[model samples]
Target: MVDTVNDDTELFTIGELARRTGLSVRTIRFWSDSGLVAPADRSTGGYRLYDTGAVARLELVRTLRELGLDLAMVRRVLARQATVRDVAAAHLRALDAEIRMLQVRRAVLRWVVRSGSTTEELRLMNKLARMSAEERQRVIDAFVSEVFEGVDPHAPGAHLAEAMSALPTELPADPGPEQVEAWVELAELVGDEGFRQRTREMAVAGARGGEQQPQGPDPERIAEHAGGAVRDGVAPESAAGGEILGRLIGPELSAEERVELADRLATFTDRRVERYWHLLGVLHGRPPMPPRVPAFEWLIAALRAHARDASAS
Candidate 1:
C-alpha cells in the first residue's frame, strides 16, 4: 500500500511487511487468511499490506502459543478471562505436590531395598502403605489383645494396654515419613518374643492375687541394692557385694529373710518383662524408663550365690 504526504508516495508490499516484522510472508499470509491478522490496505496489483498494529497482535498470539496455551487458551487470554501469571502459579503448585509424592515413593522403595525383604514382606509393605485408618486401628487392637492377654482387664495391665496402643487408629492420606517409619517399627516390635514374653509375665504377675505388687518390703530393698550393684558393674562375688546386700536387706533382716528375698527377686526382676514396657512406651509416646532389671538380675544371682555359700559355712 502507498501512503501519500505532500504529493510523495511511499509504498509497502506484503514481503516488505513480513521483513519489517521479522516474520515469513507465508506465515503472515496464513494468519491474514485465518482472520487472525488482517491487511491494512490492498494495492493496485492486489497485494496485502499490514499496519504496525497487526505485527504487535501477532507477537502476542505467538507468545501465548509458545507458553503452552492452546488456541482455546490463547483466545481466552486474548479475551481476558485469566492471566498467564495466574495459570502459571496454579501449575507450579500442582507440580510441587507431584514432586513431593514422587519423593515419598522413592523413600519407600529405598526402604524395601535396604530391608532385603522376601516376596511376602514386599506384599506386606504395599498393604501397610495403603492401609486405611480403620485398618490401622485393627492392627493396634490385635496387638493390644496379644500383649494384654490373661491379665485382669480391670487391672493396671488394662491401663497399660490403653496407654500403649497409641496408633492413630487411622493414618492420614499423606502421612509423613516418620509416621510411616513408626508404623513399621511398631509392627515388628509387637511380634517380638521379648515384648510378648514381657507382657505375658506382667499379666501372670497381675493374676497372682493383687491389684499392684507390694512395694517397700525387704524384697524391694534387696532388689534395689542388688539391682544397683549389677548396673554399676559390681560383681556378685566382690567384697562390695556384702555391703550392697546389707544396705538392701538391712541389719534387721535375718539370714532366712535375705535368702527368701533372693528367691523372690529372681522370680520377678526379669529383664525381658521390663523391656516389654519400654517398647510399649515407644509405641504410646510415653516417657522412657532407665533400664534397671538386667542389673537387678545380676544382683539376684549374687544374693542367691551368697545364700548358698552361707548355708555351706
Candidate 2:
C-alpha cells in the first residue's frame, strides 16, 4: 500500500506519489534517480520519502515528457537552466517543421495511390517533395538557360526566359494532388531534349527578327477572322476559308508576301512552347487562357494555301 503525507512538511513514499499522479512506480523511481525529484529524507528502514512538493514537480515532468520534450530539455527545465516559456517556444518551431514534413509525405502518398504510380514515379515524387526552394528554382533556371543560351538578350521575346522561370520558391505547406502532378510533369518536361530543342529554335528565330510581324496582316484581325473560322469548322482550302482569309489578310497580297507571312508565323508557332506556358500558368494559380496556337496555325495554313494558288495562277 502507498503511504500518503497530508501536509507540505510531511513526507510521502515514491509509491504514494505514483498513485496520486497516475504515473507508474517505475517512472517515479526513474525521475527521482535522475535528480529531477529528490527524496526529502530517508526512513530508518532506508525507504525513500518525498515531501508534498515532489508531487507537483513529478506532475510537471510528466506533462513535459508527454508533450514530446526530450530528457535533456526536461533536465534543463528542472535545473532552471531554461524557462518553460522559452523551451515551449523552441518546441513549437520544431513542431512546425515536423508538421510540414508530414504534410509533404502525405501529399506524395496521396498522389502515388491515386495514380497507381510506378516505382520510378514514386521515387521522383518523393525526391521533389524533399527538395529545398533553391534547388527547385535551379531546375527551372537550368532549363531556361539551356533554351535561351546564345539568343541575344536584346531579342524581342528574350524576356520570356524570366517568365518561364517563374515557379514559386516553395510549394504550399499542404499541396493539392494537382499541384503535385504539375510539379512532377514540370520536372519531366525540363529534361526532355526534344522540348529543349524546340524552345531553342523559337528563341533563336526570334533573336534574328523572324518573329517580328511586317506590314502585311494585322494580328487581331487574324485572331478574329481565322480564329472564328477554325471554331466554325472552316477548312483552310475551302471557299469559306478563302472568305475568312480575305477578311484577315486582304485580297491584294503578292505570292512573295504570302510566303514571307507563312514563314513568320511558323517561326513563332510551336505547340510545345505554348504547352510550357500553359503548364507554368497552372503552377502559378492563373486561370487558363484559351488556346491561341490553333488559331495561329490555321492562319499559317491559309497563308501557305493562298501563296500556292497565286503562284500557280
Clashes of 1: 1
TM-score of each: 0.49, 0.69
lDDT of 1 by residue, 1-313 (tens): 3442224434456687677777788877876785666677776667776666776777877776565666666666656787878866766775665664555455457767666678887676656655555676787678778867767777643566676566665443354444455566666667787766766666666545553443324645545776677668888767787666656544555556556766655556666556545654544556787777766666666666567545554
Point out where model 2 deviates above 4 Å: 1-94, 97-101, 104-115, 150-155, 207-220
| Winning candidate number (TM-score) | 2
List RMSD in Å for every model shown.
11.2, 4.9
Evaluate model 2: give its lDDT.
0.81
- Report every candidate's CA lDDT: 0.63, 0.81
C-alpha lDDT of residue 20 in model 2: 85
Could you tally the backbone clashes for each prediction?
1, 0
Cα lDDT of model 2 by residue, 156-273, tens digit: 7787788889988877778777777778788788899998888887777666663373444676777788889889999987878877887877556777888798887887788777
